[model samples]
Target: MTTHSPHPVRPGHGLTVADAMDPCDYQIADDSTVDQADNILRSAHIDYLVVRDHNGRCEGLVTRTGLHPFLTGSWYTERTAVSTTTHQRGPFAWPSMGLSLAAIAMRVKRLAVWPVVDDDGYLLGVLTASRAAGVLDAVTTP
Candidate 1:
């Protein structure tokens, strides 16, 4: 059996990752307190935070929904465990990937966002559902 790589998106379509992605820097160290993560998320007004390990490599993602139960209605505290609040590592994509296809896949998987990492797993940025929607809208709007 044989498999082949998918073709890259070309320029004529007016579809590209940069068209949808915003350069972002919301990250929290894995060992950091839940309070720290919450502060970053809230202050940035973003729904998710890229979790980084001690060496500052992308580890996983922490979302508002994942942290809500711990941060509300009585369990709220500065010392809540970041470990327990994280949604462990999931799929990631490369930066050059086309926005529309990536967005569709993420939506199908129910992922609000996904990380874009280099070959060495260094964090580049993210492809968010909102951004993807914008990309779809821009392409389909004509």
Candidate 2:
């Protein structure tokens, strides 16, 4: 599903990235296997995973494409190790951030997925490229 912006995002809409970020949809534990991550991505139909540690703190993110090397090669059996080493850190946005700023950060960082965190760094949800585009479309549409 896509989120529609209420109106055209203007220079002074005062809307923050948190306002546009989708609810938390993807989640996985630190110890979860690569296969498990892959299954979640397939089932959820999303490309990112919000990795949490034992205390449920945000650790990082792992993408579907990032697991390809470990899933299809002579080192396929090395899934566990690959997952442990390749966990990518999730980028963050505060609730007060502007949509324009968030969009710029995503683009400049080449991030397909970014996470929303609270003051304590608690994982709130994710902001994906596709979802962001949807918001843009909604806001720009009459």
Candidate 3:
């Protein structure tokens, strides 16, 4: 079944990235195996996993696509680390960012899920492309 944002976003309105982001509940250790990350992505029906370091800090992101080779290639039996497949460690949004700008960045970068972080670089949540487009369709739609 498909889901959508309940409310539509209007540019120039008071809406913010916080309004469109979902909580950061799902995560995987950087040292985790590619197979492990794949299992979580499949089970959770999510495209990405927030990779965390030993100290529990947000490290980077690992996508199902990143693990595809390991899952299907000769390395399927190998315990490839999730960190090796992770990306997007530096680009993240803040709660106060305008939805318009966030949407633009996601579009330009072709990001399926953009991480949202707090002032101290702690993860707050993620801005999914589907959710952002659903609500901010007006802004993105010509």
Per-candidate Cα lDDT values, in order, are 0.76, 0.75, 0.81
- Would you list the clashing residue pairs of candidate 1? none
**RMSD after CA superposition, every candidate:** 5.9, 7.2, 8.7
TM-score of 2: 0.77
Per-candidate count of clashing residue pairs (backbone under 3 Å) = 0, 0, 0
User: Could you estimate the TM-score for every candidate?
Assistant: 0.74, 0.77, 0.79
Pairs clashing within candidate 3 = none
TM-score of 1: 0.74
Q: Give the per-residue lDDT of model 2 (tens digit) for 25-118.
A: 6788887888888888998898778888778878878888788777876766634732374756855787787777787788888887788888
Q: Lowest lDDT 10-mer window, candidate 2?
A: 76-85
lDDT of 3 by residue, 1-142 (tens): 9999898855646668998999877899989888888889999998788988887778878887777877788645757888777367866888899877898898998887888888877788999888877877765568
Clashes of 2: 0
Candidate 3 or 1, higher TM-score: 3
- Expressed as tens digits, the lDDT of each residue in 74-106 for candidate 1 is 857677667667475855766777777788788
- Poorly placed runs, candidate 3 (over 4 Å): 1-10, 75-77, 137-142
